[model samples]
Target: MGDYTDKVKTKMEDLIENEKNQWIDLALKIHENPELSFEEHKATQWLTEPLEQAGFRVKRHLLPELPTSFFAEWTGTKAGPTIAFIAEYDALAELGHACGHNIIGTSAVSAAVSLKKALDDDLPGKLVVIGTPAEEEGGGKILLVENGWFDDIDAVMMFHPRDKTMIFRGSLACVDVDITFMGKAAHAAANPDQGISALDAMLHSFLAIKQLLPSLPASANVHGIIRKGGDATNIIPDHCEASFLMRAKTREELHSIKRRVYDAVRHSTKAIGASCTMEEGLIYAERINNRVLGYQLMYNLERIGVEVDSSEITTGIGSSDIGNVSQLVPTIHPYIKIGNAITHTPAFTEATKSPEGMAGLIQAAKALALTAFDLFQSPSLIMQAKEELRQTINQRRNRL
Candidate 1:
């Protein structure tokens, strides 16, 4: 640690404490007025307001395809690495802020501001606050990466509110598949032989998927919902639609499992005399938790009196768009413990507004600032992270 370490950390704490209320208000306000994925206009405005005011050059709606997405950046002092704090503000359907993105987005903004305020002209590198929306459904960060948004970033960090805090927890690679079946429509009583039943084809596909499930690896998941069954009870359905999500520890595993699942759907549709069309979303790759970068966050969180989860890591964690970002560069998606409730629940929504949630937000902000400070202070940290990512890629390649 450098001599300025303590000074920088103290500055972060002081600045965060000084403006704690304003950040808390931001989180609570977002929680009160939740916005769904790809529809976070108000959230974009609220989240970018402080960053723009802090002398950061703000760019709104960076993805014209996603009007809610934005990013703010600041470069200070000497040339060095560019570190980003990812912000997710999209809410869940009906559940509203049950996922605690309100806290995630505001804490990121507060952390960037604290770092800028503390370092001022002494700041060693570029600072960025990336406004990523639609995490709940559309995979906004995934789209951003596709458009070269993360090309210049050195290290990316974000803290999620969870029941347990893990520094290097993993996530699955996942994809959404929509399957549609088409068949001839006819009056059931008058022309039973003239109809090809789309419902029957869909049911056959479901059965085939169920049969294929046991053949899949234990790490993989295949689940789906039937979106459209039939329009009328007496008529042979002309069309049917269903959606399924496939997940595995990594993209390699997901690819194999996805192939089998789709094969089953195709063969099933053919057996039932129906044609099918399938639409697949972007693949959210498994999270590569850069061990080197994770340590910075773990140390900072521990220093702040938060018990970091150091257990032998468990698999089967849910997927995130951050997982997609992780594949591109060194990243850390640390979890901050807020309450006992798991995410995507009414209780979790309440926790996001509770005192405990506010405390977690402050601690998370400080951790983010301190970790960024450590990275800027030591260029070798970035090298180590990049090397770790390189090794991970080689290992994954060999496995594949």
Candidate 2:
């Protein structure tokens, strides 16, 4: 395989290296001007500029609901499998680029662009770069999948910038919920007996969740904060709102957790003579990393001198919209080490544009490009990937 594929790998590496400065600058520019989810206008513009220049038929705001979302593709003359590089460019609210998504988006477009440059018109497959926004707040990829954006794509590839480079890190299935309680208000001291305190209902709900925690499965997690408690201490609170996120290792477990937790919240509100209303965010399914493609990517990463820690791959993980994408198609969301600083911190934000982060960016680009080439170069590999994905989906459906 080395003798057969060394030429393609060399060309991929060369293409990435030749345009390293441009890609690195793109990452830096995005890091310098951070945007929140669903609002990545500048980041989207900067990332897609090079793709359009490289002759990709870029489609901006592909999803009507998400104006920042985009789909860019460069089709070869010959018909072949469609391989997509998913790009995420959303930043944390206050911490800016703490999650290192700047690198994720940059590396994806860099890979797609590099592959276009290296393979040119002789490329056997169709290449696409999806400018997916809002991995941090909204589930942009989830929306895309629901709207039939990935229906035609055969396989998808992308890497995340993290503290440790893991080959097959998994993400928990998660959902965000907002609970509101309504009650009657009165002066605290003057007419305490006449008021029904919404704050008390909210407090009871929190206690109910904490007390129920020990009984839940080890993988279950419920964390939240009081978004609105009261306007003034002198009056009995008439309205309150709290937001919470629930997570589990799989979507099945998540359903059970949500049922029990929501029941507890409802009973608590009823006990307090308060009416409750709840709203939920998109459900981020547990990630299913395609092993056949994962190993193929591991080969490329190794060839580039980047050591992949396969053992700790499942260790530290949160939720992301990519989890939804994995459920639909063969996907891999590997992580590359930039620094010891964990994600969503000021330290992590600084490390995004650090020299180490840039190094990860370049290696990720080459590996992604090479992996895409590996699939396009051989029909057997694509068959194996599609088969694995089919079996995984069937198994999941059986579980359901």
Candidate 3:
């Protein structure tokens, strides 16, 4: 926007450009060896090695409970805001980096290093790259937020690789439920009267859920798979289990849907002479984008010759652990266009390692670094973003 901002942004561009190949190589290494959620030991090591080597204070296994999660901090000479870039490296099961998380994780680290290098360590705030694993299966960032990992962060930023480029896309609130049904087992023909079939109870629950979905809001959904319907058709099943992933527009709506679904499950279990237990994983809150930060990122992307689609998306939304982090602090999870391939697909996996994907990675790193520079240069921006977050939280509470 001004001479000083332009000068600093130029430095960042040069720094990130000079080492683009290294970042791409790092991302490709992670993509080649995909790791599942909470089991990203190699990805974690590869992502953090550069930070550790760059003189940043790197902490491995940040929380003992989360083995793959780590934190790297670079503080300036003067006191100011703490801007954090979130890195999600966990790949989908069997899909292997279809979501382009290798790009997300690498871009965060590259941005932090370039920003620090561009400033020559004479900046006015702290730069942090948080290695948050398990966005695929487990809510690693949600757990980190619960454990006070994001308590002092003034702002959070991350870029996702998608078919489209968007700055203010919203995500649904979600949670996973593990349903277990227990009943007495007996031979199908030999002791038919003595058998209490858990499989029947599970089937009844599924039917009830299917019937209930039609009555619920279009934004609310309950889908699941029967993990163990029965060991054999000849025997009455004593134990059965199912896993369902539920989603809603907001946490309040999600809670209501959960209540109805759980009621149906219990009612179905009772009708079939079986007992059931429902274990819920972490509840991922809906994302609340800070307009102030979002605008800064959008402006940075535009300045760097990257196009950002600022349109509103009301449907085809998926949930993320970043949603939970957004509830706690001001956060931005914008998307950078890598290719026209849908995520979580084999085509998307190939796109993550494509030349276009590498270009997107460099663009993401520069935008993130530039945005952080702007915040450090102007303390008032941090205050404005935080105020917006406060208002957003209050509005959500009032709605609930």
Candidate 4:
């Protein structure tokens, strides 16, 4: 390795040793005080305090609509590329960090801070730590990218805690929709013929969706919940609310399946003499990974004694807001193992606070820090990442 590379590796090792306890403490604190999507006030405060103290100019982007999402930037003297370290801190509803976002938030903060310190003198670029909220619901990063937050960013990095470590595993395209059914209400025993039950409409819609399953592709998924049914047993329901999530491998495929779903909802409600309304919610695009950056990160992880299995790299059905960011910039959202627990469950919560969890955080921080150093030190890698991203986006647009 070159002298500059050696220096960065040395500094990363020292930073990991010095900030290990601090990171663990922060992770545990965030885990203990879990906050839901778009309400991560405590998490935002916890992450930004350290950045401000480290002499970085912190700016809060408060949208009149979205209060919890924000971005912080730290610039170095030498002019080069801007690298963003994305952090997510939203907890699942009632699950309380079951997805291990506490580790994600702390690991990102640790990586950004270590990178900042490593390049404090004679640095070549800028370091940005972006606190993204509501990955569980709102897709906050999608809004940020839409508003041009990532316009100048060259590369983005973040790690999620999973059962194993691997390179870029592509994610599915997803759309969340809220469906409401309205009908006339009357006494079930006295005027049953005069009542149009909204619950009956919902049942028809569910049955239609069940039949659609056989026609859907292997990559397609449809899931939903009936949020509201009725008030009492003797009264015909006047209104019913249901929410659904649709997923597919590509946006085109997602759109195709979504049309069938909408038709199902419309026909079912029409047959029951009930009107229906559909409201769009979070829509996540599929992740487009930068292969050049993926290989570079894999190399850095191996240098740090993290063995990543190639056979483990596969497409994931779950979606993320990071997918939105990847569409705009070159990005990598690699997963590092905490333990063998299934994510989004109580067992995952326990594993996230374990000793193994702390170790995984440190390892991820080191790998991310090293990868950032490589981007700053080696211009070729950064150029290749950008070029790959440009080509991928162009190809996708052409297909569209």
Candidate with the greatest TM-score versus the true structure: 1
Which digits, one per residue and each the tens of the lDDT, describe model 4 over residues 182-228? 99999999999999999999999999998998898778999999999
lDDT scores in order: 0.91, 0.91, 0.92, 0.87
Itemize residue pairs with steric clashes in candidate 3. Answer: none
Candidate 3 lDDT over 269-380, as tens digits, reads 9999999999999999989888999999999999999988887675888899999889888899999999999999999999999999999999999999999999999989
Q: How well does each candidate superpose onto the true structure, as a TM-score?
A: 0.97, 0.94, 0.96, 0.93
Better of 1 and 3 by lDDT: 3
What digit string (tens of lDDT, one per residue) describes model 2 on residues 112-181?
A: 9888888779778799999899888888999999999999998999999988888788889999999999
Which 10-residue window of candidate 3 scores lowest in summed lDDT?
307-316
Candidate achieving higher TM-score, 2 or 3: 3
TM-score of 1: 0.97
Which residue ranges in model 1 land beyond 4 Å of their true spot? none
Q: What C-alpha lDDT does candidate 1 achieve relative to the native structure?
A: 0.91
Cα lDDT, model 3, residue 24: 97
Model 4 worst lDDT run, 10 consecutive residues: 309-318
Q: Can you write out model 1's per-residue Cα lDDT over 1-400, one digit (the tens) per residue? A: 5667897798788899889999999999999999999889899999998998898999998878789988899999799999999999998887888989999999999999989988887877899999998898888999999999999999999999988888878888999999899999999999979999999999999999999989898898999999999999999998999999999988999999999998999899999899999999999998888999998888888888889985546464789899888988899998889989989888998898899999999989999988999999998999999999999999989976
At residue 42, give the lDDT of candidate 1. Answer: 91
Candidate 4 ranges with C-alpha deviation above 4 Å: 397-400
